[model samples]
Target: MHAPDRPASYAHPARLILILSLAPTVGLGIGRFAYALVLPDMRDTLAWSYSAAGFMNTINAAGYLAGALFASRMIRRFGLAASVRWGTLACVLSLALCAITGNFYVLSFARLLAGVGAAAGFVGGGALAATIAQSRPERANFLLSLFYAGPGIGILASGLAAPFVLQGFGPGSWWIVWWAMTALAVVMTIPVLLAPFHARAALTETTAVKFAVAPVVIYLTGYFLFGAGYIAYMTFMIAYIRDAGGGAAAQSAFWSLIGVSAFATPWVWRRVLALDRGGLATTIILGVNAIGAAMPIFGHSVWLLATSALVFGVAFFAVVGSTTAFVRFNYPPQAWPTAIAAMTISFGIGQTLGPIVVGAITDALGSLSFALNVSAAMLALGAVLSAFQRKVRSF
Candidate 1:
C-alpha cells in the first residue's frame, strides 16, 4: 500500500522520527502549555475570573478527548500524512484566531478547536512513530522516547520567546504572544509537509484481541491522577510566581529550565524505563514529580523554584513514555493501540476535570497555593495507587 508518489525525504526511520517530534511541539507546547505563559496578561486584559480562565482549558481538554477518540478512525481511513497535515493546519489556524479575538466565549471556542487539532497531530504522529519503531525493533524504545521529548523543543521556544514578545509589544498585548506562537508553529510545519504517507507494506495489527485491563487498572488510575494533578501546576505556575512577586526574568528562567531539563529525560531515565516492572517504575517517578510539584510552596527562593522546574520538567514527560512502555511490555503488538488509547482517554478525562476543579478551589480558597497543594496531594495519591500495580502475568 505504499504510495509511489510520496516524498522520498522521510523514507528513513531516523529522519521520520525527527520530523514526527514536531507534532508534540505543536500539539502540547504551543497548543496547550503556552496558555500558562500568557495567562496572567490574558486574565488582566480580558478581566476574567480564575474560574472563567480555567474554563478555557476545560473546553480545550474536552476537544482533546473527542479527538483522541476519533484519531485512530481517521488514520485508518485517511492515512497518516493527511491526518497530520489537516490536524496541524487546523491547529495553526486555531492559534491564529487566538491572536485576533478578545471575546471570552470566542477565545474558549478557539482553545477547544486547537485542542482537537493538537490531538489529531499527536495521535497521528504517535502512530507513525510506532510504525517506524516497529520496523526497527532494536531501537524502538529510543525512537519512541525521542518522539515524546519533542514537546521540550516547543516548551523551550515558548519559554524564551513569550517574555520578549510581551516585553517587545508591551504588557497589555497578550495577543502578540499568540501570534508569535503561531509563526513558530508555521515554521515547524515544513518538516511535516516533506514527510511521506507510506508505512511498511505488511503492517497489519489484529483487531479482535481480547485483553484484560485489571492488572494495569491501578497504573491507569495513577496516570489519571497524574493528569489531574500535574496540569494544575502547569496551568497556574506563572500566575503563582507573579503573585509571589517574581518578575519576568524569574518566569523565563523557571519555565525555560523546565524545558531544558525535559530534553534530557531519555538519558536520565533510560535504565528505569527499560525495566519491565510494570507500574513500580511509574510510581517512583510520580513520587519525584509530586515532590517537584510541591517545591514552590516550600520556599520562595529562586533556587527553590528552579529546582522545582528542573525536577518536574524532567519527570513529567517521561511519565507518558512510561505508559507507552508499559503497554509494549505487557501486551502483544496487536493490542498496543487499544492499550495506549485507553490510557490516553483516561489521561484526557482527568485533564478535562483538573482545571475547573482546581480553578474553583483557587476561587474558594483565595489562593493559588491551596489549589497547588491539592494538586500535589492528588499526585501523591496517584503514586500510591501505582505502587499497587504488578506486572501483567500473561505478557
Candidate 2:
C-alpha cells in the first residue's frame, strides 16, 4: 500500500480529507450549483428565454468537458494539490466576475470559466481523496463519501443565503447574491489552499495508465446517463419550486434541505459505496436518485416537492462517490487519474447536452414538468444499464 499524503497540519486522514473537501466546495457547490439558485433571477433580469438560460449552463458544462479531457495533463504537470488549488482559485475569481456585470456574454464566460475550474478541482480533489482513502482501506468508503459530500457545505451556505439575498434585495438584486456567493466561496477556499498533499503522490504519476473505457463501457454509459439526468434536476428545479408557488422561504428551505441531505450522504450510503461490484453501488444510488427526480412529477404539494428534494439530495452525491469507488475497485492507483478523468469526460458530455435539451423541452411545452419527467426517465434508464455491469478485477 502507498503511504499517506495528508498534510502535517492534520494527522488524521478523515480530517485532512475534510479540509481537502473545500476544493469541491468552491468548485462545485458554489461555482456549479449556485448557478441554479441564481438562474431564475438571471432569466428574469436578463430577459432570457428558457433556452438562453439553459445555454449558460450548457456552456459551463462545455467547460467541464474541456477540463475533464485535460484533467490528466493538469494533474501530471502540476500534481494533485496544485491542480486543486489553481482550480479553486479560478472558481473564486469567476464568482467575483459574476457580480461585476450583467452582460450576458460576460456572465456566460464566467459560467464557462467556472465549469473549467470546477472540473479540474473536482477531478483533482476526487483523485487526491481516493489516495488518502488508500491509506485507510477499511475506512475508505466513509472517507471518500466525506470528500464527495464537501459540496453540501457550499450548497448549504449558499442555499441558506442566496435565496434570501435574492428575496431581500428583491428582483434585480441577483448580482448582490453573486457577491454574497463570492464572499462565501472565498471563505471556503481558505482551507483547501492551506492543505498540501504529501509528496508521495508524485510516485504514482510517473507512467500514466490508459483510460479504462472498453471493459467498463456499460458502467461508463450508465454514469454518462447519470450526468445527463442529474443536472436537469439541479439546473431547473428552482423554477419548479417557483412554479409550485414557492417563494423565497420555500426556495431557501428546499435548496437547504438538499444541502442538508447531501451532508448526510456519507452515513447514508457508506455500506453501499463499499461494494466491489462494478455497478451495483451505482445502481442502487441511481435508482434512489431516479425516485427523487420523479417525485416532483406527481403533483404540486409542498410535502411532495420537499420529499423529492430530500431523496434527490441524499442520493445524488452518493452516485458520484460510487463512481470513485468503482475506479478504486477496478483500477490500480497509477490509473486512478486517467480513469477518473475518463468517467468525468463521459459524464461531462452528457451534462453538456442535458441543460439545453431539457430547457428546450420546457420552452417548447411552456412547462418544466414534462422536462422533469424526462430527467427521471433518463436516470431510471441509467440504473437499468448499470445493473448489467458486474465486478471486474483491477489490472
Candidate 3:
C-alpha cells in the first residue's frame, strides 16, 4: 500500500528534474531577470528616474515577500505540482500585462504580480526538486544544482533575443520584447506542467514538524545579504554596460556569458556542495560571487566584465543550491517545505530593499560604480558571516 518516492519505473530522474526546472526558467530567468535587458530602453522611453526604475523590481520583490510569507501554507494545501503550475501561470499573465500597458502603475502592478508568482513557483519547484534529489543522495548536490541552474536557460534565451529586438526596433520597443518573452514563458511552462512531481517529502509532516531558526540564523542573515547584493548587479548591469558605451552586441555578450557560465555550476561545485560543513559551501560560493560583483567596479574592461560575468553567473545559483543542500543535510525530509520557505523569507526581505536602495544611491551620487561597490561590499560581508556557521547536529 505504500508508494515509492518516485515512479518505480522512472528510468531518468534527471529528465524529470529538467522539466521541473522550467518553473524557475519562467519565473526567474525570463520573468524577473529579463527586466535587466529591457531597462535601458524603458528608462529612456518613459523618462523615469533611476529610483523609479528600481521601484519596478522593488514592487516585484515586495510581492515576492508576500508570496514567500504564504508559500508554506500554499504548498501544504495544494501540493507542490499545483503550486508550481499556478505560480507559472501567474508569471505568464504578468508578462502579457507588461506587453499591453505602458502605464507606470499598471506596469508596477504587473511586476508585483510576477514577483508573487515567481516566489510561489520558486519555492514549490525547489521543494519538488529536493524530493527528486532524495532519490540519489550521492548526486544530490549536482542534481540540485541542475534545478537551480534552470534560470540560466531563461537568461540565455532572453539575452540572445531581447537585446537584438530592442536594438532593431529602437527605443519604445520594450513592449515587443516583453511579448516575445511572454510566448517563451508560455512554452517553458508547458514542460513544467507536464513534469512528474508526485512525491511528497513534507506534506504529511506539515503539522507534526516545525522548522528551527536559531541554529541557522547566521546563515539566514548571510543569505539575506546575498539577496540584497546580487539583485543590484542583476537589475542594473545592462544599464551599466550601456552607460559605458557598450553596444547591443556587448550587452548581449555579457549577459549571455553569465547565462552560459550558469550551466557549469553543477559540475564546478558538485564537490563543494556535497560538503557536510553547513555554510562552508555557501561561504566559498559567496566569496566567488562577491569577487565577481566587485569586478566591474574596479574598472569596466572588456575582459574584466566577461570574467565577472563568468564568475558571478556560475556561483550565484550554486549559492542557492548550497542552502537547499544545507536544509537536506540538517533537516528531516518532512520539514523541507517549511525550512525552504523560511530561507526564502529571509532572502525576500533583503531583495525587497536591494534594488530600490541601490537605485537611490546611484541617483543621488550620480555614479553607478559607487552603487555596485556598495553591493559588492554587502556580498563580501555576507561571505565572512557565513564562514562562521557550522553544521547543525540533529537530535
State how far residue 24 of model 1 sits from its true place (Å): 0.9
lDDT of 2 at 74: 89
lDDT of 1: 0.80
lDDT for 295 in candidate 3 is: 97
lDDT of 1 by residue, 1-395 (tens): 12112234435777788788887788787888999999999989888889988888888888888887777677666666677778887788888999998988789888898888888887767656666666666666777777778888888999999977776777788999999999999999778877664643114432434657677788888998998999899999999988889777878888898889877887887777777886877887888889999998887788999999999988888888878877777776555555666777778888999999999989888999889898999999998998888888664
TM-score for each of the candidates: 0.93, 0.97, 0.97
The models' CA-based lDDT, in order, is: 0.80, 0.88, 0.88
For candidate 2, list the clashing residue pairs, or say none.
none
Poorest lDDT segment (10 consecutive residues) of candidate 2: 1-10
lDDT of 3 by residue, 210-275 (tens): 777898899999999999999999999999999999999999999999899888999999999988
- Model 3 ranges with Cα > 4 A deviation: 1-6, 199-208
